[model samples]
Target: MPAALLKYALSRKYPARHAFTRRRDLKKRYDVVIIGAGGHGVAIAYYLSKYHGIKDIAILDKGYVGGGNTARNTAVIRSNYLTEEGVRFYRESVEMFQGLSNELGFNIMFENRGQLTLAHSDAAIRSFRWRAEVNQHMGVRSELVDRKTIAELVPNLNLSEDSRFPILAGLWHADGGTARHDAVAWGYASGACERGAELHQCTEVTGIETKCGRIAAVNTNRGRIECGIAVQAVAGMSSIVADMAGIRLPIHSFPLQAMVTQPYKPLLGPLVSSPHVHVYIQQTSRGEFVIGGGSDPYALYNTRSTLEMKETLSAAILELFPFLGQARVLRQWAGITDMTPDYSPIMGESPVEHYYLDAGWGTWGFKATPISGKTMAELIATGRTPDIIKPFELERFYRFQQINEAGATAASH
Candidate 1:
């Protein structure tokens, strides 16, 4: 072993450092104040400080970093959407994710295992075909695969024609993958802090004070701090936080639940999903199966996991892999998703001047972290909405121009 490694191994007490700066007194002012210290919030701060040279940033979260939806999500990444705009936007994100670990100087454990969305009927096949075409047009590696191809891709899948929901075809996106969810957030937060951004955990924003239709200051539980620009990137609490800025968002909150089973020998490779049955499954690097489905039926702000959802998910996964019936569930969790009418994110400028909106992420927030951060940072630094994110502007809703990704997002998220 090298001298440094030998010395460290021989030392009785190992020196360990915190990933990011510890809590300190909140600054009286900041150049930019970001609400929510999740992946999106920290990524924006990271880009702003590292790329834009804006060092005075503060990321405040009610809880610790990555403890909210960032921790709850099952880190599936893809770009096979039905809309042209969605495909283009997420394509950049997927590309960014491919090089993220190197850019951030952190090991995010990203795996390009690909993803297969099983089709149960003719309707699903049609939608997948359309999505595949759109994705292909955008240079994304997506295509519709027949039953034979599906079986070849995931041999263990229950392909019995006599099953309740027999697989007909599949949407195969070779670029689809997964990563360590918390590590992504930690990487961004650490990078931003190293670049002079402050991450204030447990600092809850209480209210927003506007001066002449422009964001002036934010009142938090710790204290009041003025900011030149304010961006709200709180995932589940997007609406409530925006309301504090006196800007009402067209958002409805819903709880999305997921569970993981005890580790076993790896039996799955590609991530699998069935939109018709509203469930997706992927085995992690730790040999545990992560299973998730659509958001809860009704709108709510709670993150409590439901017994009914547990039953539903168990049944759904069993239909696809009956051999996993004996695998014990380790734990289950839920995260609140801010759903939009069009099933797409609401990004860019809001009604309040100097206040940006990164709301309406729903269940697809984790996948777009890198691109959203870069674009939102560019908008804040240049005062011009990047062309890539123009389609997601808040004004689109007023003009009845929603991007409409319901067919793409469904259980595939």
Candidate 2:
């Protein structure tokens, strides 16, 4: 390689740890107080200061920014959802990601190679046909591909007829892809900082003081902050923060784990997943085989990986690509995901006045970061939930109007 190419590749070794400058002194009062400094919360600050012209903002997190779900996700981006509402909403998110690098003035390394969800049984193929129709009706690039096309797309896939679960067809989504997760969170944090937003790491919100059914102030480990509006964008700890405001949500926390293999020559391009086997696979830009699976069987607030789940995922991957069985495992990690009954995110208003919510994000939280931030900021500034996000309101549970995305979000998120 030339010297310039070598220099650029070497730059990838040392990553920028601190994404934004911080404020040592937390203000006694602010216009907005956002809990959780993950991608969603940070993006909300970015838009509030950049687009809505609200600068008196403070973002509080118990740990470092992007250290939670942002760092643990498989980073697969797609919009081929089951429902029309979901398809429309995620479609907008995918479109926003295409221009996010230019918008944030940072390169997120978005690779739109596409995604293929394999089908094994005849029922699975029928479901893909419906999903492809819904996706195409919403202007998403998806088609039902045959086994021959699957073999062409993934040359190393095991396509023998005698396998336990034979590959019949797949939903080929041309718009599905992945991006650098760290760069995205940092980009939003840096933009928010440049626009006069304050980021307070290691500052945990412990209590919320409500005055006459409205938010008056928030008590943190450091001190109390009086704010005009407060938001609980915390992913895993959604119930804890909402309880502080005298509201209870229908959410549970579970662990979602993923593992990676040693770097090898790049082979697979588009992401491939199997809902029947409960596994998803993608080759990263650095050549590691990035594999993701469904949430743990039991509910828990832990981030520890399990041996049984690893064995299950390994067996499924081997069925798809037997060549990877010999590759040594590099590392395994987990993140707590807040799951809801409908398998859809809980966004927009909560029961308490002046207290917004962005929870129940499950394994799909990373993909919705940009749109969630934009809509949540709009709701806080205008005091009205954006029309686009109305389908995901908290009252949807009581009204029995669930979006019912459980089919698509289960193993493929």
Candidate 3:
């Protein structure tokens, strides 16, 4: 063995650390108070410090950094959407992710292995056509592919007519792919800390106190913190956190579950999904088949996995790849999602003055982390919502102008 390995085997010695940040003591006040230290919060802090020159920020989380929804998600990244605004925003996000590793000085494990959304019915085929057209108009690399092309793309995939949902066509997206979820969070956290933003893990916000409508301070389990601006990015806990500031959001929380099969050789390549059957399958870098479906039947704020979802998701996966029946499932888990009626996130200023929102992420958040952070940072610095995020404003609900992405969002995230 090498000297490093021999030393480690004998006495568990390790090399010197590089640029890493640590949790620190909370202060009485900060220029900005960001709740939730997950990917979005950390990325927001990073962009604020790097781009806006606002470094006096604090990221407070009830749990350890990236231990929440950041790690729970499947880490799929794509920008093929139904709306022009959605496409533009997410395209910028995907572009940022393409160079994220170099910018953060951290390997985020971004695998650009493309994605395919299978269409099984006439309606699905038509929707795919419309979506592909829209995606193309917005400069997204998306198009409808027939069964013959899909077979050529993945030769081992099952396309037998005996299956209940026969393969008709697919929306092939060359830009869609996946990334390492935890690494993305850690990179953002490291960059933010290097820029002088503080991260306070295990620090939960208990209350949001206001004086005469403007921002005042936030009451946390550690201590009370006075801030001029308070931004909440608590994914599943959006409603509970916003209510503390007396602002109500149009969101319902539900548990979104997923599972992975035992490792095998690289059998799956691109991310595949069937909206008709509510199943999306992707092979991880470790050769495990990561499978997931729609949200749970009833809305609930829990992370507990269900056998019913497992069975349903498994059956759906088998319909597309019958050869996977022999592979055993290694693990299963769930993440809470704050779903919105329009299937779009609620960004920008809320009813409570000086309080910003990064809520209603639903299931498509991991893909939007960078863009959300960029826009949220710009919003915080300029006191105005960016044009890219204007369509997702909270007041849109009251104005009855919702950017609907239900058809594009329901089956997969």
**Alpha-carbon TM-score of each model against the true structure:** 0.97, 0.95, 0.96
Top candidate on TM-score is 1
Candidate 2 per-residue lDDT over residues 1-413, each given as its tens digit: 89987786669686545557645799899999999999999999999999999999999999988888888899999999989988888998999899999999999999998999999999988988998999999999999999999988888889999999989988999999999998899999999988888999999898999999888999999999999999988998998889999989889899998999999998899999999999999999999998879999989998998898889889999999999989888999888989999889899887778999999998889888899999999999999999888999999999999998988887898
| lDDT: worst 10-residue window of model 1 | 14-23
Worst 10 residues of 3 by lDDT: 12-21
Runs in model 3 deviating more than 4 A are: 1-15, 18-21
Model 2, residue 369: what's the lDDT?
82
How much does candidate 3 score in TM-score?
Answer: 0.96
Task: Report how far off residue 389 is in candidate 2 (Å).
Answer: 0.7
Note the Cα lDDT for every prediction shown: 0.94, 0.90, 0.91
lDDT of 3 by residue, 1-413 (tens): 79977777667356555343565678899999999999999999999999999999999999988888999999889989998888898899999999999999999999898889998899999998999999999999999999899998777778887789889899999999899999999999989999999998889999999999888999999999999999999898999999999988999999999999988999778899888889999999988999999999889987998899999998999899989989999999999999999999999998878899999999989999999999999999999899999999999988999888999887667
- lDDT string for model 1 (1-413, tens) is 79999899768797665678787999999999999999999999999999999999999999999999999999999999999999999999999999999999998999999999999999999999998998988999999999999989999999999999899999999999999999999999999999899999999999999999999999999999999999999999998999998888889999999999999888899999999889999999999999999999999888888999999999999999998899899999999999999888999999999999998999899999999999999999998999999999989988999999999999899
